[model samples]
Target: MSAALDQTGSAGHWSPVESWSRDELESYQLERLREQLGRLARSPGHYGDLFGRMGFEPEEIRELSDITALPFTHKADYVASVAAAPPHGRFVSVPMSEVRRIHFSSGTTAKPTPQFWTQRDLDRWADLYARTAHAQGVEPGDVFQCLFTYTWFVGGLGATLGYQRAGATCIPAGSQDTARQISTIFEYGTTVLCGTPSFIVHLGEEIEKRGLSPATSKVRAIMVGGEPGASVPATRKRIQDLWDARCYDFYGCLEFQPIAGECEAQSGPHIAEDFVCAEIVDPDTKAPVPDGTPGVLVVTHLDKQAGPLVRWWTGDIVVRDRSRCGCGRTHARLVGGVHGRADDMLIVRGVNVFPSAVEDVVRAIPGLGDEYQIVVDRSVRDDATGFLKGIRLRVEGSDPALPARLAEAIKQRLSIRAEIELLPPGSLERTTHKAKRLVRADD
Candidate 1:
């Protein structure tokens, strides 16, 4: 067993309850809430506007639970606010000169959303990430190969800084040139490999194509993010089987950095209550959902000084389990990490199919990576009136023959025939940031 697995086995039995009592955790969250609100009140423009709109003084929010009374901030509001004010947007707390770095959202739906970070904000972000890495068994002297993109997106830089803070030597190999990444993994004796679930599978395939067995590779732990592959049983199993490494899942967003993360036990992602306040609510009524019930995830950043967000509505869906996790952390746990985005759900012929569901089925097929895309287009021929035409899926595959086989399997599983297209191996561009898997041609 690898060092990470050994640590996981040893620490797996410890529950989050052992780390802190419920009262103690609540106290800590309340303290952080005061500090964050004070910082927001002192800032100029946007925060003041929000506070005025809420018709309450920042001081009125004494306890952490009082945060629920505040109105939720949606992505559309932030985008509009930013458009009205260029560059940093009204959310920026510090002056432009004080800002050290800028990170933008992957913007899978529309234009990318930009987030500014001061040196202090960066330090806090890194510290939280380091805590997560250490809890997951990444140790000092361990070499980490960061496979996420290092462009405007925050995943690459945030992870690299966090790993470095944890005393790991990170190989800044952003997602590109799989051959070179595999070569570096061997050369540097990297112990931890970090990337999206799909990219990791692609790297594994490249390693096999180059006559490399990932089981014999120096990598010991694989950390995945940017998607829900870690929570999916078949997809997670495939990645672990391919890399011969302990796979840990982390769930976060551009609006709120590092909301919840996995430890060695891999039971679920533990929410970082010290830094974030999470609310699982029914997407339709905006009412709190019972524990274990899947709902829309809303977040509030507690320690962010540069661009502190309050009750930010993240379009992701997840189930929150307040019961203690297997890991020794008092924070709430996301039972299966992020299930899927609210917008990604498709109702096909009285059956609901999420892109993630399709992805799970596709990834389960042997010899296929997570590089496929679902193309939905309107049927060119007019159908009979009163019956709406359903969605079509054009799955991208590396091998020319795999699409037909995959279509057959999907038909058997989903009980619907989906048009599958087999493009060239590199036909679909590999992205280092968020993988754009679902494309609506009719839109």
Candidate 2:
């Protein structure tokens, strides 16, 4: 057994594994990785076929770096597998009788990907979330209001169970009804608010609009994820200023439950090294990159069952740091959280642009509102071949000089020229869940 798992830790930590040395963490990870891969080899599923095709054996994995040799499981692969076998695909390791719950991806691309979780899988997810919440300072007295979607999306129920495990009074006030949510916060004395960065900012705006101050509220910690805003410096500052709370960024997807989170240091979110082996790789090349280099994040579940995934490509851009955090945790940190998805990155005039980058620039401007959208329209040519003409940033602001100021800022920061459209405040749609930052004009 791992020493961290065997021994308990201080009140500030949920587990002793958080402070394990690099070698100790990797040793534990290797043992778990080999066990999971061995199960994959013995099982009759997509992984077996993938291993056979690659002529790779689980026993050949002698060190952690050997994980790079394993095949990456992409979203397209999962979709195709599901098409071949409906409902839970061949990727599900256990039988249907064992599956206790089924969650799904947000399905922003095509159809929703089903995630199979047995009771053990579910318990592990909740425990991982509990560890993250504990790191964010959730105690028995804290009342947590989860604002992430509660349906097929895994964010809500997983977080709700986790905070409850951490001894907090949890309210499953999922994403809806901004006014009622604010009232619930005051009535319940909710000390912890969990939602995407966009909704929290929206809630803060609504509070101020009602001739109230969100700073005076009892909320001390705001845990935000399911989007990129919480890691953006300007957006983080905006949220902290509005709520007078310590804003923490969590990085996880439906496929992988709550896997990483920020501690009290607030520098970056520490990856749960014992639960998952996180790799930063070049998006196109799929080769491991050095620490501090921006790359697509690939994760492998170390202690998952029912549907264990190997080298699941997340596509979210991020930088990793291996240095021990000031909070005294030895787990590697995702330095700026998720920096948009590789698929969502837009290339304009020989420059790559991400919506979060635009947001970072926009939010830093003095008079801009919290809501903004990046509109993509085409330029029709004589031959009927449509090309990406340009990007138009639609922002809500009443300041007459805002357009020129924002355009200049974008040019300076992103090295690309984009048309700026300033609308009156409240013109853009407010979201209670993940904010839609990019949209095609034709759509």
Please, what are the lDDT tens digits per residue for candidate 2 over residues 113-225? 89988999888888878888888888788899999889778899999998998889999999999889999999999999999999999999999999999999999999999
Each candidate's number of clashing pairs is 1, 0
Q: Model 2: residues >4 Å from true position, as ranges?
A: 1-11, 379-390
- Residue-wise lDDT of candidate 1 within 1-443, one digit each (tens)? 12233334334322232266668877877788877877787668787777777676767877766887788888887888888897557888878888898888767655777887788888777877776787778888899999988877778888999888777998889988877898899888999989998788878877888887988887888889998788887789888898888898998877777787787778888888777878888888988889888789988887777788988889888888777666556678888788888887665665666677787778777756457788776662125542213445555556677767877887788765677666655667766556777877766
Error of 1 at 257 (Å): 1.9
lDDT of 2: 0.87
Error of 1 at 31 (Å): 3.2
RMSD of 1: 4.5
* Span of 10 residues, lowest total lDDT, candidate 1: 9-18
Most accurate candidate by TM-score: 2
lDDT score at residue 144, model 2, on the 0-100 scale: 94
